[model samples]
Target: MTAARLGPQERDAALRAMADTELDVLVVGGGIVGAGVALDAVARGLSVGLVEARDFASGTSSRSSKLIHGGLRYLEHLDFPLVREALTERGLLLSRIAPHLVRPVPFLFPLRSHWERPYIGAGVALYDALALSGTRTRGLPGHRHLSRRAALRIFPALRRDALVGAVQYWDAQVDDSRYVVMVLRTAATYGAHIASRTQAVGFLREGEHVTGARVVDLETGREFAVRAKQVVNAAGVWTDEIQEMVGGRGQIHVRASKGVHLVVPRDRIHASSGLILRTEKSVLFVIPWGRHWILGTTDTAWDLDKVHPAASRTDIDYVLNRVNAVLKTPLTRDDVEGVYAGLRPLLAGESEETSRLSREHTVAHPVPGLVLIAGGKYTTYRVMAKDAVDAVAHGLGGGVPPSVTDRLPLVGADGYFALWNQRRILARRTGLHVSRIQHLLRRYGSLIHEVLGLIAEQPDLKQPLTGADDYLRAEVVYAVRYEGARHLDDVLSRRTHIAIETWDRGLAAAEEAAQLMAGPLGWDDAQIAREVEYYRARIEAERAAQEQDSDQEADAVQHGAPDIVPQATTVRV
Candidate 1:
């Protein structure tokens, strides 16, 4: 009924409302799928309460390859339906859903030999066709065959002899973390009660029927009960843990597959378009970010820490070696600006290799009260959410409305095109550079006015964050004021992506951000200092962990930085 701005006051009010009411659906986990589930349930006229232990998208959702793409490589295994579904979702996101956040990106898939050319070409053609068949297909160009010379013109950084030819195909990319936040915000706008930094301790059961859950406010040491008719567990990698909380082994098992990515300056790669190369284990992507390039993804089984999946020296070397195999000028550790590792929650199967495991999601009611949804890629999060909510509806034993999320645009999706067209006028009116206005438009879409309003209120906020010029100081304030960023890491890591974009990993801007956040969060000078110190220590710990050779060693080093949320309250069950 009212606009849902996820500020501190709004979060507190939501948490109070959640504890007091008997919701129709209580969605656990604040990752993309969980956020989607909350939105779907709320949109269907259900009273919904969504809770997260950490910041929204604090886990794998934020740490992904940031692509909303159909897995073209899946065609090799004849997973046509999965690929098609993902492509259709990608089309929807690009055109109808979050058009401002999701945009088309081109990738050059290099062909190693003459025979490989036709094989890869046919697969790519099918990928393009699948996208076009989608009802909401946008204006992305189809795949095209490019000779070695022609491909070189687009990607001169490629080694001349690395490919016989290349197939340029279309996909889409997003600020994965921001998209999740937007989804949660949209759900809140539709009357969903949402709270982050709220950990679910255990399920509240009335003799095997899940009626609700006991949750703790990690920010404070307060515990409360949220009652719901049905509880949906969309905890991505933590699916198994939530199942255990329900006192069962559960019907499904989720395996953690760690994938690491590297960030380098855009100039270091010299590519007009993104590059996708085949690897021994899986495919490697060198995605194009605005000022930097995202080079990633090493697929390997991880049994260590799920919270902080550290990127070890070996992991970094593996990505570098894979990308270096194709680059004319090799990229070493020095060229790397940042590194992040995330675990993919795969549905365990007969295959030993994690990459070979199924990305298709499985939904099951493990117990009378709990519904578990696990194992899907980022591209099809909405579908997974819809399926999970449908299960909840069945349990409720009523004519619950069908999911309308397919037609529902996120908060900023509407009026994005018109806003973009008037970017020049907006820049002039705001007394900001056109480039800065464009940057804000891309990140916030129609919400740019809210950010500009902050700058208007505080003229000093127009200046960029100290040492992190890419972001304005007003954006940091905004993280706390509107985006529910309670801590420095929440702003640095998720709300703005300053952590991965900067070489210092957001250390240089940590203090300034903490100061900006202090006023809104009501932090005293002492609290501000503590937050800054904690952030600095986190950066230091991450740097030390990256030098380790193995996951165990990296995890050990990373844990040296004490968690801001007290361990006693993080995961009680």
Candidate 2:
């Protein structure tokens, strides 16, 4: 089967089809859950339309800790069902669903005291057991205990006094934003109309039932109506705001909880494995990325701007301080390469603290033709999508088939294992190093050929990007030609992760990448300069925001860089 193409022309055609065709389900939001819902619905023989207000996974889905695990901490809270369900999903993703994008990463949980070993070990044993109970958990290694001396050997960056011992366990990691795009691409392949940079202004309702939506293309300021029988709101942090469009609060409230992460170069930390530390409010993860280590997350209540969640000086200090307590050589602000903050859409409970709020999603059909699915983690998106579509199936009422997405591998998954086995052969054929071929295989899987094809046509595309050596020039072109990237920010921030991966926040490659993208995007000299200027302004704004102490101050500073794709000032839907 041919892979789906999501280039500019295809996106325009999708938008036109969404306006012209009557769909069975219209999924609003382009995050992981929305993308999953689109794939599920279309796979079930239902005509589907997926619309996003911003770029796909620009919100919380893009800014996660990048772990696909069973929520090990949730076991302490006795949320067995959530943990079990997530573990099952983790197994499926590792083995079946997206082997290319998702792979296992080892995490060492340091024990502070000798007495804590058995206690923590029991929890981890349960975690591994739950995962193994699943039918597809064959490849991942189980948890193992290591002596303090042995643990220190594996992670020399950890202070010897930081732990009495450690427990090592496996969890899968992903390039979260890329995974979302791949899911959408798979859905598009299955015949779903998809449009990004399109804002849903209002619901098209007939007497009290939502029939469709009034959407505007942010790129071209063109407004049109998309007609559908059922509309699913998977708008993440913006769920409550979308619900207000229909009438009342819609029987569910989603609270925004902010989480922050810091990216530091790998050489700064002499650790071979990732580290997971327990904190006062939540867990802190020092995750391993390709050329960098991702240290994150502070869980705090946030009521500020949701579009651009800013990580203030206070938040950065909190994370650094928490991780520094265990590091042999503490990481200073200068050591940090990037900082990002994302909001978690928690189902508002009686608890005042967002950390205590449940991650389990809630589905509600407050009205006849509308469904709202909110408050799940990145790991359980497929389940949430299945449930959302199941509700839509019920609403549709007939011989609507159940979800077959579990059996359906994503577009890149089909020939991945075979290609992975032949990485050396591919390296010889492409004249690229074996290590480079391995990187491409991990990213594009079987679709690596499409990327190689570009280099095959133009050998210059094989050269590494200007500042970000890990990525090739071919990737920047590929993002525009096939992956639906419209602006310089899209390529740097989401498509290749050059923004967070580089110390300059991709400023060094801004002009080079924009020039590369200009050819495919049909940008003139003026437009290319404008795109570069916008990206630089954004980097400066974020840098200034990081220096601020509070969310309010940071938000004020960050909003200085306005979005290129202007959204509606006022909503009628």
Candidate 3:
């Protein structure tokens, strides 16, 4: 069956279809796991419909450490199974599934003492050994112990007092937001009807069971009664809220912990390999991101604003002071170009500290028609998706085929490996630099042809974005056309790398991006200008908040600007 892509006009048609019939699964959220469940369920010959209140990956999925590791720290907690499962998925991602997106990254774990050398080395050794046991991991290398001399060869920026030696371990990195977008697209390709900016308000109940849901289209003030046999709630932070919607108290407690990261020029930390420093409470990473190095991530408890977690001066100072302990050239507040904060939906447990909460995700049948999933790391999102869909299968009320999503490849996965060999030719054909082509390949994988097609049609689209020059103008159009981008920020921030890549943090490129999306989304001159100004205000508020010393102060400063008008905030465009 050819899958449906719900264009703007088709929104009414799509909602009508939803109201007129029954679906096997109605996924409430549109994050990584919900998308995965929709894809998995549809591929198994079930009818699937997924809706997101915001753009795809607009939440925690978009803001991540960008690593797809097997959770090396989880081993310290003796969660060997969790680590192994993550490694298995990591291998699958690097080798077969989304190979274009996930790639190997070596991390240097500095050993401060001589005893630390053997202790950490043994842990990393076990980590790699576990990967070797997996099917798709043989292509990657094993762990290597680095002498103090050998370690300095790779990272000369390390302070002499920082380490006695280092242990190098292999992991993977990804564009978390792009990956989720890909997940949504792939699910759509498998015959799932997905519309972003569509909110599920209340349940459409039939006697004791929730036969469907009452939803409001955020773009147009239209109401919908989307009918389905099963509704899967993959809303990360709002799982509890969704539970309350169905008159059920949440079975599992999910506490939100804020993790903040800062982006600085790569030269700030002169290191060939990524740094994974052990903090007193949690681990801090100085991961290499394109032309910049992204760092910081305090695992402190945050109960304030979950939607916009602001990075205060204290948070940034803590990360800088901790990571700078090992840097030969220390980083100051001025070195920071961009800072972002995300709330982690940690599975609530007995541990008083947020850092101690389990990274493991769980699924529960909150009601006969509703299934809830939350609290997992980005790397293991596939497992969480699979598990959520599996729970949905029980509520389908028929003999349904088993989930074969593990064997199923994402839409762009098949030809991505082949695209790698012919990237130079692709660059030559498109009149783009090999570096630019490589960037698109990593982001879009085999779907680079789709992005390239946009450039080919409008030759001027090949030009790079003015302020956020690393991204091409065609990417902006593609975000609106294919990736379901609804607003200016959606194009500049999540769909492309422009947000964190630029020094101004996408403020300069916002207008151009909005203009590109306007044709597809149908925005007028006044609306486009409003979008640009709003994004500038958001960036300004965040910058002001980052200057504050404490979370409460930061939250006060950040939230002072005003509420962001998400399309779902009202119903009209």
Candidate 4:
């Protein structure tokens, strides 16, 4: 396999190559599903090109709940197939695909009433059984029932009267943005042409048949055409917009459902395991992230600003009130370190509530030479990719091979276990702490050598960032040099997650990170200053938006900060 270095040089080469060649498949999104589609198509031996208007996973993909489970709540809806498929993919990710990035996390489902134990217990049992029923190895432990005392012992933060008992079940979690980048990297290794900050402005057509796309490099504002035999639209919430570029609506309509999450310090939540609480409209998860607890998710209709979904004060208050009901020590607004909102691309349905819409995906050849895929959960991204590529194959007269992604390990997964075992030795050799080595192993797996190589050349790179101590200075450099992070936001928001993980929302680290990124990205002092200013403005805008009472007000406030790269407008062909 080729080295999956998505640096500046590789990105330039990809753009030139994509423009020069007529690809067998061209994908129009860089979210998880689009990344998966690229990987699946390339692994199937097709010439593939993937373009993203912004950074990878900049949309809904990066803003997920970050769980890889069988959707235990889906069992109540009698959606066994969706749950089973997600479980299979979850197992594959943990064991075979991206072990370095994904790991199992335990969650406590607090039982409210005596009768609810047996009711929810059956659902949990079925969830476990469905996981086992899959062909892939079940990488997590089974669920366990706990008495009230045992539940309290494990989760002392829970209010005494809140639960009669609890059920502890295991699910996998991942840094969603990082995983998307890794997936694209793996796809690049398989010969997929990958380029971020490139937008599809319009579709190329030959007398009503979609043949390719007219694209613009967002960084340089250079317009070009990428000719492709088959075009796959995995544009998630922007599916309708992409379809409109083709001059009409596709077979399905995608509606945006806003979900908001609050990040609080882990010390605030005194639990050995994460909590899954029941809400009136949907389920709420208090997930255990590194050194922090991610409490969230308000599901409501959102029609504004798909790119930057804003979490209103009402949304934050709703989450706090819901989680506070079961917590012994109620959390306040002051406890929140960060807030983020993402839109779910649900297939529009008859139900008025966004929560009632389908999580299942659909693929349609709305026009010849064009395939549209939308509306799937994150965990089942591979399956969605496979199906989308299958549609592409059919469009290309059906000669494409089956998807080999299920058996293919991502770039960092192959030797992760060995690297993990030798972390202490690595630490000793590099004069770094074992904990630091372990952290690198979890994030980069066998690819830790690539990061350590930068540190070997510059000893100062080993030091942790001033604001986000969890990450090293080398990470910012790595994000620019190897991970295709073109801007400060790419590193702070997606690549390193310093934006949402820090108390100051990465404001303190912006100048340093921009300086570190300058050498590789060729950003002069002016550009560096501009990058820092843009990030600071973004942080301020988000803070202002979070204070608003409604989504409309919040969205308007969040839009105050213009995108660092001007958004490309779609032109009608």
Candidate 5:
């Protein structure tokens, strides 16, 4: 297979190719499901083209709780199939698809009462059993019942009175944004035309049959019609808006559920394993991220500002209050390194609460040539993609082959294990620490050479960013030259995660990162300054928004910072 390079050159070439050729499948939205759809279609011998309005995974996909697990909470609702399917996909991701990006992480579920032990224990046992039954290799250890003292041994920072016992179970975590980019790269390798910062302005139709979409390149403001046999609307939260362009009442109604997460220094929570605490509405996860603890996720209905979902002061306080209820040392706003908010695209159901909405996705031929897929969790993105492509196949008169994505390993997965085992040798040869090589292995897998090669040409690239030492300078250059990072936010927020891991929210690294990015993207001094200023303004707006009391107020504050890439005005056909 050819190595897929999604650099600026490739992106320009893709847009031109998309305009010139009529594709078998045109995928709108570059989130997890959309990327999955592109990969699935192209791998199945179909010509595919994917367009994202902004940077890839810049929406809900980047801002997930970062877990790849069967929804343990959904088992309470007796949704067995969803749990089983997600577990199967999780197993595939860990064992086959993207082992470098996905790995098992243990979570301790504190048992409040004696009865709660067996209750939660049984649920966890069932979870493990379901995972085991789904795939040949479960890819993680089974759940363990722990005494209060034993639990405290694993999680020293837990409040003693919080629980009598605990249930420790395994779930996988991933760099959500990175995984999306890898998936798109993998898709591109299979001949999918991938273009970012491109928006679908309107649908192209002929006598009531949707034939294609009229897309505008946000970077250059060039509008062109991308002709395709089928169009898949995998636009997550923007599904309704996409549907409106075609003047159709979408069969599927998607509601946005805002989930906010707080990132703090790793020292703040001295837990070996992550924590999953039950809330009145849902479960709150204290996920273990590298050098930090990610405490998150308040499930509330959101009706405003889909582009940048803002986390309010109330949202922050709610998470702190819930997490502090069980922590020996309470966390404060000052302890928070960064905060991010994302919206979950939920299928509207009979329940009034957003938490109760269906996570099971639906694929519809709302129009003859348009296939819309919405309302699935991140873990089951592959299944969602398969289903969406199945609809596309039906719309194309059914000669398309079945999906081969389940057997396909993503780009970095092939030689990851071999390279990981030789990390010491790589470290010695590159004159870097083994730990740094390990970090690079986990992030880029076998593709570490592409990054290291940059360091070899310019040895200074091996040095770490001034404020965010976790990432090397070479990684920033690689993000633009290979990973399709179009802006400063793309590098800091998604590609490297300096924005959420740093104390100043990447403010210190913004200028340096922009300067590094300038050479490859051909940015002048003014453009570099503008990129830094926009990033600073964005961080400022997010900080101010977090102080607001309500979502509306937070949305207004967040909207105060203009987007670096101007949003395409949807031209109704």
Candidate 6:
């Protein structure tokens, strides 16, 4: 039913089930870790229900560097164990978990002097060795070294005087938000109730133990008394806030660290292989992403607004300054096509700065019937999830089954590779380009057939989104009908790349996509107009913020940006 899509109707029904009956686990966030926890709990034969204050992975989980690898930077820190663990997870995601989405990407590290080559090459060799030793490593090649002339052959953008040689290594990348939605949908396929825009206000306490939660439906302002035996707080940066809801202090602190990134078209930089340069503060990655190369990522402590971490002027300049140092042709603000900022939920101890904090995660039973899991990197969300569910299983009262999700396939895993091979036939039937079919298959896997059917029923749906020409109208229609895209921003910004890809930044196409979605989602004219205005104002504010150079200035400009009606109006959790 369309009710499965976390809209007004579905949220009410799911919350009723949670309130009227006991649940095995109730997850309080829809980020990757929260979705993973729900999937894990359900796979273990437990009844599960999940709710989110925003859309799935709307926070830190979605705004990642989008790499799934044993971190090369961690090797320099000498944290072999953490690197090994992350590498194992990367292997699992690429080899078995989501092979269609996560694929290998090669990165080149240029050496400026004669002595630098071996030093850098040794580290690259160690990275490859560690991945090979990990249980999850597969479908990736080993690291290789290149002479100065050979390196120029592959990446002519490197200045002749700037580098002497280079080393190349393998890693995996993904569409972070897309993967989070897939996890939420897979949990739904397993009969775990799911809803978004449902805010967890406070913990329902039976003495010292949490029984469920009092959640407010953001759309209708109706409160639900959800009843679950165990509630997992996987709220990422909002970990401490969720912890306070249960009236408990944390054993470990979670500090919010902001990271910024810039996206520029591929033609702006002439390079065959991607580049990874070492910045003074942290590592910088220029990874290839479709028609563009994603850059930046400044690791600085941020105590600003958690909801929307605006990219300060300094952050953008810092990235451009560092990357342009090694490039033959320097980059300027005009060269940048898009910019984004995301917070990192870092596990802080007695560290001087957030950058010094550990990426390791911890699951704590802050109180009976309440569990809080936070502070981990995106690449290892599944492992973090398995640990969180393992902790919750002990409180379920019965003998709980072990997690079997490692062997389980997600929503479209059954015959995805075979279906991907048949995209040519799909292209013929839908009268779409083979490139369009390939894009659908990679993003939706076996679910590609469902989207194709929408086009078949309505031939007009075959047309691409106006400004975001990369997406088809079928996607915009299906996002509301099936993927729980409630507002226009959700469809353009999260469900598709229109917000970041185009020069006008989705302003030109907002109304058309919203009009297409309103019918399927039962939205009125006012709602559609509100959605379009919010998106346009937000785009203007983001652009204004990008023009300013300081955090204070950028925050002030972005403050004027259109703000959404947060799901939880109280904003405590």
Report the Cα lDDT for residue 458, model 3: 95
Please write out the lDDT profile of model 2 over residues 401-441, one tens digit for every residue.
98887778887898899999999999999889999999999
TM-score of 3: 0.96
- Residue-by-residue lDDT tens digits, candidate 6, 1-573: 221354446655777787788898999999899999999998888899998887778888778888887888888899988888888888878877887778789888888888987788888888877778865447478888889999899889889987888888889898888888888888877778888878899888878888888888787788878888899999999888787775546665789998998889999889888889888777899988888899968999888778888897788999999999988999998988888899999988898788889999999987889888998888888888899999998877659888777776666555778978887887887788999988987788788878888888998999988888889999988888777777788888788877877788889899999899889778899998988888889999989888898887888888886556664544222
Quantify all predictions' global Cα lDDT against the true fold: 0.91, 0.92, 0.82, 0.93, 0.94, 0.83
Clashing pairs in 1: none
- In candidate 3, which residue ranges exceed 4 Å CA deviation? 1-13, 136-139, 562-573
Clashing residue pairs in all predictions, respectively, total: 0, 1, 0, 0, 0, 2
Q: List pairs with backbone clashes in candidate 2.
A: 202-573
On a 0 to 1 TM-score scale, where does candidate 6 land against the true structure? 0.96
TM-score of 1: 0.98
What does candidate 5's lDDT look like per residue over 39-70, in tens digits? 99998899999999999999999999999999
Q: Give the TM-score of each candidate.
A: 0.98, 0.99, 0.96, 0.99, 0.99, 0.96
Off by over 4 Å in 2: none
Collision pairs in model 5: none
lDDT of 2: 0.92
Better of 2 and 5 by lDDT: 5
Give per-residue CA lDDT, model 3, range 1-573, as digits (tens).
332343564445556667777898898887787888888888888888888887788888888898998888888998999999888898888877788788898888989999887789889988987787786453467778888899999899999888988888889899888888787777877777887778988877776677777788877767778888888888898777787777755686788888889899987877798989998887999899988998968888888877778999898999899988988898998888888888889999999999999899999886678788998888888888888877877777658777776676676777887788898998888789999999999888888888898877899999988898888899888887777788777887788867777788898888888888888888999989988988888889989998898999999988876534554432110
Task: Find the 10 residues in a row with the least total lDDT in model 4.
Answer: 133-142
**Weakest 10 consecutive residues, lDDT, candidate 3?**
564-573
Ordering by lDDT: 5, 4, 2, 1, 6, 3
